[model samples]
Target: MKSSIKDVVGEMVTPFLEENHMELVDVEYVKEGSNWFLRVYVDKEGGIDIEDCGRVSEFLSAQLDERDPIPSAYFLEVSSPGAERPLKKPRDYERAVGKHVLVTVYEPVDGLKEFEGTLTSYDETGLAVAIGQKTYRIPADKVASARLAIVF
Candidate 1:
């Protein structure tokens, strides 16, 4: 059900993003307590502002109202993914090269499931992350989740 909502929301928002020169980061449909939230994350080359979010929210809200694809009531939220944005796509990984990141794999890579460090390289095969002095080669297929990491 959540996947279906995400799919429908993605379909409804793609054109809006393209038309507005924004990139769709992600779509999440999740329940929090007794409420359901449909979150739309968007970004562009320079990042997005609140006004951008508002525009997307307005457009999406109208579309959702018209289509009524969701059976239950849900709050719609459109916003930027922020500095620690998720790295979900190949392009995202490519762009994240040389940046700090946190990557988790389904299975252990070198006996470790989580690696946090600088993303040294990314390619068709996989990505290389340098954690301190040690560099680990993590297969793309093995990755369960990845996101930019803020170095404190």
Candidate 2:
């Protein structure tokens, strides 16, 4: 059910993102408390501003109205993914190389499930994270999720 919604939303919103020379970071449909939220994350080379979010929200709203794809009432939101933006696809990971990142593994690596450090390298096989003095090579499949972490 959730996958279907994501696919539908991705399909509906992708053209808009591309037309605007923006990238679709992610789309999520989830229930929190008594309400459901359909959150859209978009970005570009220089990063996105509030105005970009507003435009995407307006355009997506119109598309949703015309398609009427979702039967349930869900609040629509469009925004930047923020400091800890998730790496949803291969390109995202590639772009995130040389940046600080936080990654959680599907299983423990070196007795640790979480890793936070600079992303030194990434390829089809795995990612190399420089944690402190040591570098750890984590298989791409072992990662549960990864995101660019804001360094203070």
Q: Assess every candidate by TM-score.
A: 0.97, 0.96
Best by lDDT: 1
Q: Which sections of candidate 2 miss by over 4 Å?
A: none
Give the worst 10-residue stretch by lDDT in candidate 1: 1-10
Which residue pairs show collisions in model 2? Answer: none
In the order shown, the candidates' Cα RMSDs to the true structure are: 0.9, 0.9
Model 1 per-residue lDDT tens digits across residues 79-111: 999999999888999999999999999999999
lDDT of 2 by residue, 56-97 (tens): 999999999999888999999999999789998989999999
The global Cα lDDT (0 to 1) of model 1 is: 0.94
Candidate 1 lDDT at 112 equals 98
Superposition error at 135 for model 1 (Å)? 1.3
> What lDDT would each prediction earn against the true structure?
0.94, 0.93
**Residue 12 error for model 1, in Å?**
1.0
